[model samples]
Every structure is written in structure tokens, then in C-alpha cells.
Target: MVVLVLTACPAGLRGHLTRWLLEVSPGVFVGQISARVRDLMWARVLELSKDGRAIMVFHADTEQGLAFRVHRHDWQVVDVDGLSLMLRPHEVGGQSELRPGWSSVARARRARRRK
Candidate 1:
């Protein structure tokens, strides 16, 4: 099985994907396809996406039973201890900062003790 998520891509790209994959939701596509076809589709996405971003997740025989491919996305895939993981960037400028939702709601009580 393959899952593809696209963001900010052209409408034609999404329409093109629907031929082989089901558009379960807007910008989200899923289907079972051969590796050759999947690769071709990914190439097509990269060609047509322009300034957009896309992520593809597919079943594999690895430790995680899945693999990922990302294009023009801030989050990245990394290998750690023979495992694949998504690395979330810590800093926030154009992107939102990574913070615990609970503590982010308001100033943490612990901050008062720092002074």
C-alpha cells in the first residue's frame, strides 16, 4: 500500500493522481501499486509540483515496515539506530515552534521560579 500527501500543489497534479490512486481526502491519496508505477508517479509529482510539497509513505520490508520520501518539506526523515524517524525541527521562524501543548497555553509555573 502507498499513501501520498500533497500540499500547495497544482490542481492538475491532484487530478492526475486520481487516475491510479483514490483521493480519500483533499490532497491525500492512497492505493496499492507496483514499485515502478509508484516511482513514476513520484517523479511526476516532483516534476509538476513546482513550489509545492509532497510526502510518500509506502510498505516496505524494513524494520519499520514502511519507508518515506519527502519533497520540499521542513520535517525530514532520518535514520537512527537502524530505525527511520521523522525529525521535527526545533526552531520556529516561518514554522511554528515545537512545544508541549499544555505548557504553551500559558506561561509555565516553573518560569516564575527562574528569577
Candidate 2:
């Protein structure tokens, strides 16, 4: 199985993809094709996608049974402990200033509970 997601790409590139894959939704394509064909399509996408971004996920023999490739995307793919992960782009600092589950309301509730 193969999944191709495109963002801000040209119509020509999308049209070229539709020839081999099914457009499950706007900018999302899914299909199963030979590796050679998939590579060829990816090449065409790179040639025609211009400044657009694309990500392709496909079956593989890896531990997760899948692999992915990204082009001109902010997010990055990383490998850790033999697992593939998506790494979000961080701010200028090494960590993000904003933290999850630390909303003001939550903080107020915590303060009341401590009292």
C-alpha cells in the first residue's frame, strides 16, 4: 500500500498522480503500485511540484513494515530504537516555550486542589 499527500502542488502533478493512485481526498492519494512506478511518480512530482510539499508513505520490509519520504516539508522523519518517528520543528530554542496541559484554567484548578 502507498499513500501520497501533497500540499500546494500544481494541478499537473496531481493529475499525474491520479493516473496511478486514487484521489481519496483533496491532496491525498492512495494506491498500491510497483516500487519502480512509485519511484518514477515521485521523480515526476519533484520535477513538477515546484515549491509545494509532498510526503509519501509506502510498505517496506522494515520493523514497522513501512517507510516514508518527505519533500520540502517542515516536519522531519527520524529513526529511534529501530522505530520511525515524525519530529516536529522546534522554535529557535531547543524546546518549545509553550507546554501542553498547562492552560491557565488547569493551573487554577491545581492551585485550588493544593489548598
Candidate 3:
């Protein structure tokens, strides 16, 4: 089974994918197909999704039992200790940092760092 999530893509691209996959939701597609076909579909997306982002998740014989790949996305997919995590893009000017938590101590530390 393959699941594909697309953002900001052209309608034509979505139409192409709908041929092989079901458009379960807007910009979301899912279906069961061979790996080769999946690759071809992604390649077509790459060619057509000029200003879009896409992510493909499929079953694989990996430690996590599944694997995912992202394309043209702002958020980054990172692998750490056999786990997959998503990291959002850092804010401009680095205003607020994602620290341990919003404890009083954490707030105080941020204030101290500014000084």
C-alpha cells in the first residue's frame, strides 16, 4: 500500500495520480501498487509539482516496518536512532526557541540568554 500527500500541486498532477490511486481526500492519495509504479508516479509528480511538496509513505521491510520520503517540503524528515521525526523550519530572526518546555526556569533561561 502507498499513501501520498501532496500540497500546492496542480490539478493535472492530481488527476494523473487519481488514475492509479484513490483521492480519498483533497491532495491525499492512497492505493496499492508495485514499487516501480509508485516510483514512476512520484517522478511524474516531480516534473509537474513545480511549487509543491509531496510525501510518500509505504510499507517496507525496515526496522520501523515502513518508510517515507519527502519532496519539496519545507519541513524536514530526519532519522535518529532508527526513528523518523519531522522538524519544522526555524523561525526567522530566531525569536522563539523550542526548548525543553515552558517552565518558569526555561523562560528565565531565555531571558538570561538575551541579556
- The candidate scoring highest on TM-score is 1
lDDT tens digits, residue span 53-72, model 2 = 99999999999999989999
lDDT of each: 0.93, 0.91, 0.88
> Which pairs clash in model 1?
none
Q: Write the per-residue lDDT of candidate 1 for residues 1-115, one digit (tens) a residue.
A: 9999999999999999999999999999999999999999999999999999999999999999999999999899999997889998887686557454456443555565556
Clashing pairs for model 3 are: none
Per-residue CA lDDT of model 3 for 26-83, tens digit only, reads: 9999999998998898899889999999999988887887888899886788989988
Query: Candidate 3 at residue 83, lDDT?
Result: 80
What C-alpha root-mean-square deviation, in Å, does candidate 3 show against the real structure?
Answer: 3.4
TM-score of model 2 relative to the true fold? Answer: 0.81
**TM-score, model 1 to reference:** 0.83
TM-score winner between 1 and 2, please give it: 1
Error of 2 at 74 (Å): 0.7
For residue 67, model 1's alpha carbon misses the true position, in angstroms, by 0.2
